[model samples]
Target: MELPEPDTASDDAMDSFLDKFQSQPYRGGFHKDQWEEEFEKIPLFMKKAPSEIDPKKNPDLACLQSIIFDEERSPEEQARTYKGEGNDYFKEKDYKKAVISYTEGLKKKCADPDLNAVLYTNRAAAQYYLGNFRSALNDVTAARKLKPCHLKAIVRGALCHLELRNYVEAVNWCDEGLQIDATEKKLLEMRAKADKLKRTEQRDIRKAKSKEKKEQNQNEAVLQAIKVYFEDEDRAELYQVSPKSTLLQVLQHPRYSVKALTPAFLVCVGSSAFCRNYFRGRKVHQVK
Candidate 1:
């Protein structure tokens, strides 16, 4: 077949290059013309080709639609192409574009459970990176629903819940995910934090309850002591009796056992001995 004649300007440029290259006399057996002929056969080598930019066009939804209808490319290849583009977008941190690419890929090959989980999981990661925790959780949930055995998705979902301050749900998700893959370090860490928070909250609640109980008990004790003091004849009569009468009664009372009251009366005796010892040591040190 007669290939289209080379463009005349390209042909002239090639001839000029070869002429200049051959004019170097010391370079022998270079076969500059033959080399030029061979180079010309390649479409790109002949000239500086015009740049072909992929126009900054809106996503070609039509092309995607046609790809869906076309039976030529295997479903796997189509998915691969979409996923490759999606990954490229992800690397660029263009998460919205990446999600679109992954979603389109999923539409083509919905039956691939692993791929579905991976796409959704990746989208969830992007969402999380973008600080859209709720959306990320949704994607993770969708992924887990499709592939119930997806441990990574479960962990990521738990993390998302944790960021959203749903501590109980986060712990629940981590617990379930750990049931499947216990060695997941991040899941364990997240669960530990959630449990710690729960414990701290519980401790605060218990402390409050204990404080109220103590106050109630103290109030009840004060009431009982007041009632006893008012009703007891010795105390009540002491209030009415003169000091001399009380003293006489104390001296005369048969139940005023000094031995029984000895321990109670010695409450300050131990402290007095310790204070004397401490004061003597201070005095000796000052003298030294």
Candidate 2:
């Protein structure tokens, strides 16, 4: 039975229909226009994405600086405000933010050395929490330079050095702090820790040196034994003993055998005798 040439036209038309049907845009999802309308409701300040906010030129930060640094506001008051903000952040464990606030307070450049010292010390605390030990040390140094007797800065400096594995520097800083307040418990504790670590490090070094020396001495002793065996004339005479001599005959020889020698010397001389017998085709047991 011959099928009619097959309805090519109808087949092409059906495929076109299926393709267009599937290709139509889905109407079930929210449209771009609806999303745009919702987005417009957000406040302008809140609408600025994090990527749009420049760290160095943030508008909120600029506004904060303007308020604090106003000519009408006392410098001391401004510094205190910034310090308080930093303290708040520090209490929240936001150390990087605390550092920023403390730094802003310092930028005010207040005339009071005590206030500046406090600011520097506070920033050092933040830096320490952030694991910037070297930076913390630097801040503490600045604080100390401004007020030599600042106990907090001195203690913080010691702690920073301890974190950096600078035991000697930590001890020195602790000593400096103790000079100002002899009964400071924190300084005493830090000094003790540094001293203990230093002692442990020194003990390890001494042990390593002792082990190395012992090994070197053993090696030298072995070399010396070999040298003496080769150089001693009395031992060298054993080489002239006849290969045909029995084991007991060698030992019984009047001039060859000796007594009261050290174990190491005896071993060396015995090894030489064994080698001489081995080379002359005498069994080792035959020369006992």
Candidate 3:
């Protein structure tokens, strides 16, 4: 492409601008009040970079900016470029910007499994640093789908599971990572930690279940005794039942069947205020 010749007409204009500078010094452009506009134009003072860079407005940056996301490039190439940009941001610890760049790379939907997996894993790292563990885990899952034995993805997934308190799942993921690279130190350490947590959780569960079962058995025993005393009259003891009855089932039962009809004996089943109150409230014959 031929470079456009500089307009000679601009020479006359440039001379006039220089002539004005020598004749009547330009005060308006140099004034402190006009400096605010210049400050606003600088990127350092600006809150954010312009989304759209106009060549006329930013001629210096136009070429570089245009080349950064050239529409002529293939999606795969564009995605790769974005990955590089993301990596730069990641190295600088600008994780939020890195996540945005990686997301843009993924949006390209490149057919290269390796490139896509890398983008996913990189995004997972950014999200992880940003405290979005679930999002990081999801990105890790995507990376693993593209490359099932991805050690980084496995490590990230295990970490996410650990944060979420899914100790068993974390151990499983750590195991998967160890399978691919047995010598990986991170995987080894994570697996050991996760395994310990999983075992502790299981032991606690077992203890809780055993204690619950014991309590249930005791409650069932108490209920069964109550049933025998109230419904199965023959299960009552000799003094608990009518003193006239003669049955082995009466001597074998453990429930209280208080207030015998005869005065020969008083059935006071040990320190039971509830039973005493109930007996007092009853209209049945009471023998002192």
Candidate 4:
């Protein structure tokens, strides 16, 4: 049986219907084109393209096999690749980038103790340069845990504490480093620097405290002088005396008796000219 001749009108209608269905707004399926546009807007560093990050597809079997087979494609090699990249950034003083590279190397999870220690220490160095002292200290501490005698880690940890103004911790870390390699020039130098800084800081604190105490003592002395002068009926009358008022003029005031003036009091009043001046300038004090 021969099929009926195709109807051009119905064929065009069917084509139009299929075209509308195909072009209908996607409800939730992955839209690669739209995703690409949005993905492009993200920073290059933040964008992990699917092809580059598919764990199932790109399993690190080569790295694992190298560890098992002792081949060059080892985890160490992979970790070192990122570590070397970090070192290059560090040398160029690109500390932020160095931190990123070091972090990526650490994510490789290499089992080599020395490599892990170096990775952590190098990251700490980058963090130090970036003024992330707390983060640097944390990384250095991790390095120390891995290899307690790691000289670079010890030095960096001490410096991190120093930057944080934790002089005591800085001194402690420096001393620990010194215990390992007493002759190591950098350790020795850092220890001495930390010690000197700690001493200087302590001295400054003492000086500040001493100055505060001296000010307090001086204030107490002034208050004592004021209290003594005001409480004495004989000297209380002198408080009203003007700076230019003479001793003889003050003595002649009705509030004081001529007989009440002691020889020492008269001598003090005559020498200073004014009670306030006498109280302020004289170390010896007497009131009657």
Note each model's CA RMSD in angstroms: 17.5, 21.7, 10.0, 14.4
Question: Scored by CA lDDT, what does every candidate get?
Answer: 0.68, 0.76, 0.78, 0.73
Please identify which of the two predictions, 3 or 4, would achieve the higher TM-score against the true structure.
3
Please provide TM-scores, in order, for all candidate models, with all chains considered together. 0.48, 0.54, 0.61, 0.52
lDDT of 4 by residue, 1-288 (tens): 999998999999999988988999757554676876554434352343232334354345334334533435667887888898789788888899889988988887889989999999999998988888999999999998999999899999988988898988988998898888888787677778878898999999999999999999998766444322222344443333343556666566455454435622332233334755655644433332
Clash pairs, model 1 backbone: none
Q: Candidate 4, clashing residue pairs?
A: none
- Of 1 and 3, the candidate ahead on TM-score is 3
Worst 10 residues of 3 by lDDT: 227-236
lDDT of 3 by residue, 171-240 (tens): 8898888889999898788888988988999999999999999999998766444411232235432223
Task: Evaluate model 4: give its TM-score.
Answer: 0.52
Q: Indicate which candidate wins on lDDT.
A: 3
Q: Put the candidates in TM-score order, highest first.
A: 3, 2, 4, 1
Model 2 TM-score, all chains together: 0.54
- The TM-score leader among the candidates is 3
Error of 4 at 35 (Å): 34
TM-score of 1: 0.48
Candidate 2 whole-model C-alpha lDDT, 0 to 1: 0.76
User: Each model's number of backbone clashes?
Assistant: 0, 0, 0, 0
